[model samples]
Target: MAFEKGGENAYDVVIIGAGISGINFGYRLQERNPDLSYIILDGRHEMGGTWSLFQYPGIRSDSDLYTFGFPWRPWTEETSIAGGPLILNYLKESAQMYGIDKKILFHHQVNAANYSSEHKTWSFDVTANKTEKKTFRSKFVLLCTGYYDYHEPLKTVIPGIDDFKGKVIHPQFWPKDLDYANKNVVIVGSGATSVTVVPAMSRTASHVTMLQRSPSYILSTPSEDALERFIRRWFPVYYQHKLIRWKWIAVPFLLVTFCQYFPSLGKKMFRSATEPQLPPTVSYSPNFTPDYNPFEQRVCFCPDADFYRALRSGKASVETGVIEKVTADSVKLTSGKELHPDIIVTATGLKVRVGGGIDVSVDGKPYNVPEKYVWKGVMLQDLPNAAFVIGYVDASWTLGADATAQMICRMLNQMKKEGVDEIIPRLSDKEKNTMKDAPLLRLKSTYVKKGKDVLPKAADRGQWQARSYYWKDYLLAHYGDIKSSIEWNRS
Candidate 1:
């Protein structure tokens, strides 16, 4: 049910972004409050935002699908890592099944949003198909715009790049027609993107070279197991979801918490069991050690048998040096080696974009997001009548997103019962400083890391104190253990 259409328009919430995170949030909203009037808007034409846009060959989820997929739904497939199309299809089916598809508006991209101090509402300008602009007002603005936009080619400024006669492509924007068959390829960056492409291009490409300045902390894990198969086959959907959630998610989450607090024990255990999984040629130097735990910075992928097969095929190789220059047909390595290349895939990785390009303001001025602080990394503290749905970098993004959903429900309940007109989380000077002192995910490179100013950081709990793992996050938001750290009450 919706309100009468007239001059007066006020929806319960307006959710931006229709990716996995936003889609899940929208479904949860209606499930919790069936009568709540809301809209899920996205800039793209399809329901699967990232999965749709990223159609490069061999794109797959690094996180295991069981927990990483969705809470209400479990991945029924036998494969451990769900590829782009499969994941996209799953999201589409999930949306349709829950009736969240009706609330979605494609091609409707949000440009800016202003929070009204008086009305306690959010005003937004949505542009669709470039020319059509529409205005809407909502009691609560939910920014589910996944991260920031795609990171364009890196700022590395590789010399002679223009001279390269061959094609240069970023994995995010790979054209469908670009063929790698029988072509020699030089890929830039050793992050997740490069790692994924190595095995994929090796299958058909004559030769594939991975260029890296410094090696990333990459680890491997199996995609599926016999036990997982048996459980899924025997169990009901809800039962499977719970079992998979706890087994895959809860265990890892607790381990992450243990590691953060007790680094020595965590490191010792991981090095013993996890480190052995890496090929003998792999590096485990402290330089590559993430500022946080193993899964803290980003989840490393384990590509069942395919990754190893690619490595054994000799078609896949790695180069650890800077690129001094690129010629039309050759790349000059920092080590003074000129390697000929037929194709150059600059898989240099992506950057973070905050609030999916939505403008956030406080006190009639542009909000300095990183400085303001976070309410569990989802809701903005200083902003009024707004909350965002962002995922974790390490663990399953859905875990953090799920927590945000639960917390928003609690916040809504409190608002209804308390008649709260406003909410602003005020952190003491010391508490605020502490939050700034320790960030959950930290990467130094300008290309890989989100700029402190524009994109902003999730002023969230210390990944150590508050693990990004699913179960702990569920408990943190559900029970509110971090209450001392948060400031909440009736307006």
Candidate 2:
């Protein structure tokens, strides 16, 4: 069923991705006003977004389950920090329980959406079910479509990959029935995907070799417990936001602060703390560099679970080396070591593609997403009647999106109350000139940037602007309002 193209009716709002972000956007709006008309569209055959496509072994979220799950629905005792399948089931369950499944059109890939100035409606051309092509129209379109692709495996060149006789696969598109029970596996990359595979395959595979370009500092924390809940309830929303913000700030702040305050003494004290954590056999190298701080890029891993279990069992090993080439049955490393493997998993990380690889244009002029400054990281200054939901990376995905959705809902309510039919975030020329992106290495989101502005600035590192502190942001957003936080418009 197409939107307006269905002849008689069109939803007031249409969400492009059915993942947690899009689904929450729908739920939040519906809860705010049950009469609000909307439908969610996903490219996959099912409702789960990333959780559905990434079927690799031991695929589970790095974040805690408490806030990561959903806004209205707490991850009850039966469901918690889950694997891919469990999360996918949760999405399905949410869709079913919310009565969103009927409205969600699966396997419907939205190719492009154009906003009409005169009509103030979005015209969308979508490839549905990979067979029939059609167009749908809506008053507003939410690009909830996340960074990952559903149709194919991300391509990576390993030189002699074609010559390798063993089966090869990307973590995003693993073959379900492929047997690796007694296989020797060599997985490339040290990102989240690689961390998951190391422990999972260890249970069946004879051995799993992990290769990485450089060593990333790893840390762990408990998923959920009484202490966190107490913190959630004990502090006022604003105070809690301040505390978490300071917590994020304290890491690099203390380092940068002490170094400047007591140059000599602080330098000595810094080494005393960090040096003990380095592997005893490996000497400390000043080259250990993190542009911002230890947890800057995203810190997710089960504390003393999969990653720890794999290391303790000696079934999984880590090596800092690049892949030089691939052979018929082995991979050649830059260090001249040869690894013969039965399966090679390219956990090399996912490529970020915003707008589902569809180009965004305004008045026939092509515009890049990063070229514009992100207003509260949701509204693009120059876009009218539009908002995209962003997920939590360090904290909880649902929490971040929930706040974004709330703010947008507030904007919509304000617009209606004030007789306004439009709202747009217009960028100032100076703001655009100073516009900077968060660096690619330190960011895992779909948007790309040249410098540090892409991630939340250190000065703005609290619940509203910080990237890693999930609980802080989740709580703040749940109670926050966008109408108060955002600059809007009226008719």
Spell out the clash pairs found in candidate 2.
381-425, 381-426, 395-470, 420-491, 437-454, 438-454
How close to the true structure is residue 345 of candidate 1, measured as C-alpha lDDT? 85
Top of the candidates by TM-score? 1
Q: Give one digit per residue, the lDDT tens place, for model 1 in 354-452.
A: 787667665457776666556566665577767777677657777777888877766665665566655655566666566544453444544545455
Off by over 4 Å in 2: 1-9, 78-80, 152-157, 221-292, 359-367, 429-491
Instruction: In angstroms, give how far residue 163 of model 1 lies from its true place.
Output: 1.8
TM-score of each: 0.87, 0.78
Per-residue error for 410 in candidate 1, Å, reads: 1.5
Candidate 1, pairs of clashing residues: 80-223, 148-353, 163-328, 164-327, 164-328, 165-328, 221-302
Candidate 1 residue 212 C-alpha distance from true site, Å: 1.3
